[model samples]
Target: MCARIIRSLLVVCASLAVAANASAGQVQVAVAANFTAPMQAIASEFEKDTGHSVQASYGATGQFYAQISNGAPFEVFLSADDSTPAKLEKEGQSVEGSRFTYAIGKLVLWSPKEGVVDDKGAVLEKGDFKHLSIANPKAAPYGLAATQTLDKLGLSDTLKGKIVEGQNITQALQFVSTGNAELGLVALSQVYKDGQITAGSVWVVPEAMYQPIRQDALILKKGADNPAAEALVEYLKGPKAAEIIKAYGYTL
Candidate 1:
């Protein structure tokens, strides 16, 4: 009698597991490097609430655009700049009317070592550092903003030889964290938490110095029929994701 009851319980559990698996879906996402932390947190919450899983690939937005254009399998894209998604929509690479601004990014000049950067960002003009890191301006919007800030401050030509370029914003932060570069111009979301810089010294770049970094999210053409893709897009615009984005210091 005991063995029979145990077997029956096992069968019921298996059936329930199968039902759960049948309902759950997965979405592939291409994310910008700067938004990695918040996206991961949001993805976790999204999965818990919706029973859907997210597979995220992080990199420069320009590179992701090229890949998506060439038919990459990503169902959704969270770009570092609004212009990239606009271009994709214009070229028919993304689902029509599915794009929206998700977050506005902030740039910062930071050093992992305390006191290396000042609140006023006078370090660039002081020229006390050997290597200053930034993302590749051609591929990363934050890099373009950094350049713009430098130009506005009249320090671009003066600091050219001292600059070291990273492939993306994350790598640019790494260069500073690892001591390879004494200072880096990187996305604020990379180091901020709870309305403060989590580590090191930082100078938050003023918005007037550069173009606003308007990050956008959209479903790709390939994701038109994927329910998980549509769900994830809506989730990003929901209250839960907005809280997470704000906690990471991104303006939603």
Candidate 2:
């Protein structure tokens, strides 16, 4: 009887997945730049598992928030900070009660050159590097955290001239990766994953150096009636997606 029940449950689950695919189409997602890699992986797996496609646009979370406020046709938003989604929900731009924390991001001070940045983040004080890249503090959550970190270290003013700002974290990473900047304050997921540094050297910033970066996701008003959008959002909360996210070095 137990074997029969298990078989029946499998059939039901398969039927549900098929039905979901038949009913939904493609979901347009606005994702924070820091989450680009993992979201791409998650989207690919989600398409394979459920046959629902995702079209993702990655940029600074604040820029996406502004665009959404001005009627961007994004079906869903994956913000780098929790407050943006909450504000959208309050403004009726997103589906109420649809906001949920998806990842807890970690900040890192990274340098493409090995051993250039120590674990204690003493590189900033050394000031030997010609340039330090950071995302636009006014527009990116990671940038804001970088700003707070610099302030906490009392280097905000002293390092002003050495700083180069990128429009988003992706660009900031590019600045450092291509040797345009000696180092950068970037998202940890961008440089490290699966318990190893993907490239270069890194100083993982202490959590107390800045505010918690609790990233969140929400179904936008434009996606309220989109079955694909809702399905994609739900899929992100599933174990498969969580595994992908954690593999990228983000905490659940």
Q: Model 2, range 1-252, lDDT digits (tens) per residue?
A: 999999999999999978876875898999999999999999999888768799999999889988998888999999999988888989889888889999999999999888899989998998998999999988899999999999999999999999999999999999998989999999999987777999888999999999999999999999999888889989999999999899888999
RMSD (Cα, Å) of model 1? 1.7
Worst 10 residues of 2 by lDDT: 17-26
lDDT for model 2 comes to: 0.93
**Model 1 misplaced stretches (Cα beyond 4 Å):** 1-13
TM of each candidate vs. truth: 0.95, 0.91
Task: For residue 92, give model 1's deviation from the true position in Å.
Answer: 0.5
lDDT of 2 at 126: 88
lDDT of 1 by residue, 98-206 (tens): 9999999999999998998999999999999899999999999999999999999999999999999999999999999999999999999999998889999999999
